[model samples]
Target: MDRETRYEDSHVSIGSFVLESGEELPHVELAYERVGPSDAPVILVCHALTGNQFTIGEDEPGWWKGLIGKGKYVDTSEFQIVTFNVLGGCNGSTGPCSINPTTGLAYQADFPFISVRDMVHSQKQALEQLGIHHLHAVIGGSLGGMQVLEWGILYPECMDHLVPLAVTPSLSAYGIAYNSISRFAITKDPEWKEGYYNLEKPPAAGLATARMIGMISYRTDDMFQKKFGRKVKGNPGESHTETTYDVESYLHYQGNKLVGRFDANSYLYLLKAMDMHDISRGRDSIAKAAKLIQPNVLAISFKGDLIYPPHELEKMFSLESMAHFYIVDTKFGHDGFLVEFDKWGPLIKQQLKETLKI
Candidate 1:
């Protein structure tokens, strides 16, 4: 495995698994990172798109260190935190990039479509195989947040608490629109080869452009203006003559960063899963979807998030009489819940206190 893509993590074979679409995977493997006490209430930390099972690190810096540290919202002393690379993810998990045992080639375009429910079911199978029948909570943001809601809907009694941050019951039309454009950027690229590209000639430009599009949606316009304005990206003392905008430079940097570590097909598949994430699809209505969530729900909404704005979450969770909701006022947009710790971190701690009595 390329170091840029990923190295192996703690893995558990989940045997044969069937997706919600009736597609069956002959064998499934889930790569995860578990930390904290050996015997303690479990806190399942789901990762966002493009993220892996490196939430709480040993020799490396964990992705959510600011929020999952020693004295952070999810205090490790009181709970064991386990995070897994989503089933359709490339990071040490079975994904479009993984080999299909029957064909002895990467799944690629041949990989069956998966939904958020499929991801939740696979994770549940993996956990149960490891003798974990119950969970303390499911914590995640954005893509991870979608998984959190799916876990609550699919296996309501499997967890005590559900902390879904910056996400709604389903990806809004606006969100899907963004995903559609991103996928188009990848599929149209010549090097993409219709999802059959090898490692040597991956769709670098297309994936990078898709990531650039995603970077814009992740943060707010106000944030970009405040951070970069109309400044030129160049040397400190260099003359600003026909130079790239600072904001453009930042987007390019983010795009390149993802292209280096992520598989383009995995990105497309995950986006499709997100698009198929509607608890109401088979259940009839969002109200019914809310009704299926038996666990204590604590969902956070962001005022600056334009993609899946706070009003959408407010309207959906409103269907559930007992669901707790918090709206944080921040300038960071959809990524705020993932970036700024002070805003939503305390809310998580409070929820943990009420649910776990810690």
Candidate 2:
């Protein structure tokens, strides 16, 4: 496989730090990679749930390709984009699938529980190692967007501009419930065996089910209706019936693909971290936490995104010192930030020009 086709794996050690659960992770290692020019202005790109460092256009063109390459929104010609798989991700980072240096086997269920702040701290170590004194901007969507918000709060001094797309400060009660159900589905599978299923026979059924649950929320009702709409398209003849609507096939493809690249334990870990994400926790109220953000903030949401509704984003902005907040109207729902790049690319370019003055 080409170097770019294979996942890039690199690590940076973060000296001792205590976790939210009162556990100590000494010398935590973060995994990351850089795209575009080294001397260019730095823009840290955080991926959403299940995403890795391959954030720019590659293979089939990454979800953010439209806005990130040469002469584009992020404009690699002027900005060096750094994307990292989050700390607990299965890609190249230390997660459940990683071998335990002590046990000489995959960490499995023994991997330490982590938090969003913990992930950011690890990324901070990676950035410092790369000689980035400060960032030109921090940008992300969904859970990635949550990381951007955390960056503003935890390391305000290291960032100049903050762009959080399609996300909120904390998971709503509904969101928490959704995650809980997904976790339950995974744990209930016969093959899970408390997160230590046989590697050769992983709990693919459970993981696919969990993904199906998530896909429902990540997209819009209208999109499903238009794409599926109870229409049954016959599949290739086989022993078992293989018929589905366009949307059903799409969802199944997404679910199966996730099971191939992602580990069940890592998915559970990251979901829990997202559930625990509340910027206001012990710091202040939501409004107060938002007020502490000193850098120019840009919060973007999609009109059709039911998962991170536009109103919720507005609530976050109401509490912040924002340079601008925009809702890009689209039918693409939460995934709009990735799919409707044509609309947002120019807008992002405009924002960068005004803020970076490039």
What lDDT, from 0 to 1, does candidate 2 have? Answer: 0.80
TM-score of each: 0.93, 0.91
Error of 1 at 241 (Å): 12
For residues 1-358, what per-residue lDDT tens digits would candidate 1 score against the true structure? 1111122249999988888888898888999988776666888998988888999787888889889866678877777888889988998888888889999999998888988888888899888877789998999989899999889888999988999988887788999999999999999999999899987789999999999999899888899999999897666546555446788778888998999999999999999999887778888988878888998888898888987788877777886766788898888988887777888898888787766743
* Model 1 segments more than 4 A misplaced: 1-9, 234-243
lDDT of 1 at 3: 14
Cα-based lDDT at residue 226, candidate 1: 95
Candidate 2 worst ten-residue window by lDDT? 1-10
Q: Which candidate leads in lDDT?
A: 1
Q: For candidate 1, give the lDDT.
A: 0.85
lDDT of 1 at 87: 88
Compared with the true structure, what per-residue lDDT tens digits does model 2 show for residues 1-358? Answer: 1112222336666666577678775445666767765655678999999788777745557657767776677777677788888888987876788777677888899889999998888788778877888888899999999999999988987888889999988888888888998899899989999898887788888888899889898888898887778776665344364645677688788888989988999999999999998999988788778877877888899987766778876887774545578899887888888886887767667666655743
